[model samples]
Target: MNTVQEAKRYLDNAREILREKAHKEEGYYLDTKYVKMAGHTAYVGVLVALDGLLGKKGKGRKGVDWYNQQLSGLDKRPLRSFVGAYDTLHLSMSYDGNPLASVAAAGLAEAETIIKWVESRTVEA
Candidate 1:
């Protein structure tokens, strides 16, 4: 599969995991493990989308820090979304046992938005 296809696959996988595994009926996730897993999964999807975008510009795969730096120079909306995912979903869960449901939900939404934005800029393999 191509870059976009790969990114979409990751995004879809993250969405499924978030909906099925990370979801909680109490309005917030109680399972720290699932929260961390979901965050990591969604973060991976964001990275894949970033790779797709950078690859299109003749850039090779880079670290998360590099991606963040690049994102800082791009559109503010997606950059904000990316930052939210990175901060709340990707990193914050490690230190917090019970992350708020709104935070996780927002992270997922941001990731999905980033994936969609990347998809819009890419073509099928």
Candidate 2:
């Protein structure tokens, strides 16, 4: 729960950055990517909390495997798909060559969606 609170703070900061970037005509694009990643990280934090709330955090494999297992049961297809897409984008952008502008934009959108989902789920959790 404390970890969730901290993650929520970070998520709030990411949203603030995104709101600022949205106001800019041509903002710092990479910062937008960072915001997306930050948002995803926050989502992960929320998942951990929710899993604990639901008593499913340690029921499966550890780490991302456990995360994926929980994600597999979600009823929200769009959110699940966006999370999968962002997972791919995060790996690509972190380890491979630079991502295209469109990829970054897509990642940002996915991150934003995930953040919104986290916000709603956290309340329910």
Candidate 3:
């Protein structure tokens, strides 16, 4: 499968992780581990879609800054979405393990926005 398809699959898996594993109660996920896993899965999906659009770097992994610089040259809208996704999915949820369902929803929305943007620019792989 192509990068976009793989990325979408990652997103699907992330959602399943949250729905099936992360126990939601009182508007919050009770399991931090599942939340973190879902967040990381979704974040990687965003990166995978971006890599398809922007081309993958060789060797060492690139940071968000590099992505920002490259995306800034392309369009400001996706760049903005990328920033939100990075902060919400990567930092708040993935690293800090935020359990807020609303926060995860927002982050996922932002991830979707970026993925859709990438979709517009790329053909199926």
Candidate 4:
């Protein structure tokens, strides 16, 4: 599939995972391990979305540092939100197991926004 298609797939998959697994249900008990898994899955989707954006720009697949550098040069607001999402969702929640629900929610929202922005810029051939 093309980059835009790939990005949309990742975003859709992420949304499904978040809705079915990551999000906590009211008055329902969720396992910590499952929560952690959900966080990791969500973060992978974010990375895939970034990869799609960069690939569309002919940047090839690169690491997160490259993504950070590109974002820093391209736009400040999304860059800030991307960094925040990386810190809280990728590092704190995915790795450290200390993600505040509100913070994770916000980070996921930011990721969704960034993915949409990237999609808007995609020029399908």
Span of 10 residues, lowest total lDDT, candidate 1 = 92-101
lDDT of 1 by residue, 1-125 (tens): 86657766766775576577766767876567777777777678788778868754446647666777777777777788887878877787534534577787777788888888777766543
What's the ranking of the predictions by TM-score, best on top? 3, 1, 4, 2
Q: Candidate 4 lDDT, tens digit per residue, 1-125? A: 76546645655655465557654656331544544555565666666766766654454666667878988887787788778778766776667655356655766677777767666766542
Per-model TM-score versus the true fold: 0.76, 0.50, 0.94, 0.71
What's the ranking of the predictions by lDDT, best on top?
Answer: 3, 1, 4, 2
lDDT of each: 0.72, 0.50, 0.93, 0.64
lDDT of 3 by residue, 17-65 (tens): 9999999999999999999999999999999999988887776889999
Question: Native-vs-model 2 lDDT?
Answer: 0.50
The RMSD (Cα, Å) of candidate 3 is: 1.8
- Clashing pairs for model 2 are none
Give candidate 1's total backbone clashes. Answer: 0
Better of 1 and 3 by lDDT: 3
Off by over 4 Å in 2: 1-56, 59-61
User: Which portions of model 4 show Cα errors greater than 4 Å?
Assistant: 1-29, 56-61, 123-125
CA RMSD of each candidate after superposition: 3.5, 5.3, 1.8, 3.8
Candidate 1, clashing residue pairs? none
